[model samples]
Target chain A: MPSLFFYLFTAITLGFGLLVVTARNPVTSALCLAMSFVGLAALFISLDAYFIGTIQILVYAGAVMVLFLFIIMLLDIKAEEGKKPNLPAVIGGVVLAVILALQIVTVSSSYSLGKTPLKNAPLSLNKAAETSVLPTISNDLKVGTLPDAKLMGLTLFKQYGFHLQAIGLLLLVGTVGVVVLSKREKGGQDA
Target chain B: MITLNHYLIVSALLFSLGMAGVIARRNILIIYMCLEMMLSAANLTLVAFSRFRVVEGLPDYAAQSLVFFTITVAAAEVAVGLAIIVALYRSKQSVEVESVTKLQG
Candidate 1:
């Protein structure tokens, strides 16, 4: 049953992923990318990564993509003349696709993927346990807690707090830089 | 039905689509969306591998955390990148890559 949801979510995500690039309108492509993010988040939820999935929907699909759309709508420009795409581009794209397909097949056949330690891994979470997911199916598994979002929270805020803060500060700086770069006076340009 | 290979196949398709967008498209905004697609493909690969192979049927907390970080960075990147593009659009009134002057290569 859960796997059913997974397949559906994966299909939706991949479909929107294609549409994001193929769509001609910039606004439409941005919206499709947002849909793709939501679909991916749903896939994460079906996989039992509840917290991460929630944040994915909230942050990426919610805040970030909205920002992109706001800009797209605000700066409504007529579509520019598309480049005269040629045969070489098509051939290169096909070559890359074949290489990636081969990689996926090689990866699937070699690794002992599905059968190893996932036969009966439990899905329930214990409240006091802090970690959400159940124990590893590996017989020799030794990790005490099944380290999940809560544990990740602990690590991010405690052990890696500085790095996290640094990232935040970096984002703030980027935001300011973008605003400054984009809002410069037109008089300064040579054209 | 939902094997690790299934996720990989999806990721591969997403990556290929993104590559096509990058190679063929002239619109800068669409190219940026394609870049996001590629990044999402990488994230899917990381989470799938951590879940199936590394953590071995356990909930891969580290993968989730890494995915979160990647999303955060991607969010930041799009913010600044799109702002620049918007500014360019305001100045030149277009979003075509070849016309952007910075992407002639």
Candidate 2:
């Protein structure tokens, strides 16, 4: 069952990702990107990171995509019908993509590449077996605190609370900047 | 069962597709959407790694939280980026990157 879901979401994500790039209409590309985001959110959920998955749907698929669509409408982008495909650019992209795929596959196949250093390190530092931010469990305990949405909230509030505030500030600044840059100057020009 | 490699392969494919989109698309909006796709692919890999790698027998929630922060940043980026695109369109009347060469002047 799990494998079935993993494959399904993987196909959805990759397929829509391709469509987003290839669709001639900007609006269609945006919509396909939204679908890709949905598939990505499902993939996150399958990994048991429920909070991130929900935020993926809410922030990415919902808010960010809506913003993209609004801009597309505002700009009134016509169908990109007459543009000639640059053969050199397409060929370069394909070659680079193939090289990247090969590199990632090669690097990922060696599972212990980054693990050896930790494997020899002290258990206290590397594993933190005795203590952590999450609720502690005995080594032989049948149940453990698997990182889920609840644990994620605790981690965010405890460890990253200040970072959250900083992000809020960044958002505020971005909002103001957008408003100022986009607003037409009085009696001058649309820009 | 799905392994970490499965997720990594998925992410790699998405990232490369996004790269292709960025290169092939003439429209700035489509290119920007492709950038968002690339970010999503990276986030997927992060969450997947956090899932399989156990520290002290507990899942690494920190990576998941990092993904959360990344999403927040992406939202802000899209808003500001689109606004800039709109502003450019108002003055230039087109969103093609190749045609907008005023920056070079």
Mind giving the per-residue lDDT tens digits that candidate 2 earns over A98-189?
A: 78988887788777533322223222322443464444323323343343666677778899999999999999999999989877899975
Q: Estimate each model's TM-score.
A: 0.81, 0.87
Off by over 4 Å in 2: A113-147
Choose the strongest candidate by lDDT.
Answer: 2
Chain A TM-score by candidate, in order = 0.75, 0.80
Q: Flag regions of model 1 displaced more than 4 Å.
A: A79-87, A114-149, B53-58, B102-105
Error at B54, model 2, angstroms:
1.7
lDDT of 1 at B87: 71
Would you give me the overall lDDT of model 2?
0.81
In candidate 1, chain A reaches a TM of 0.75
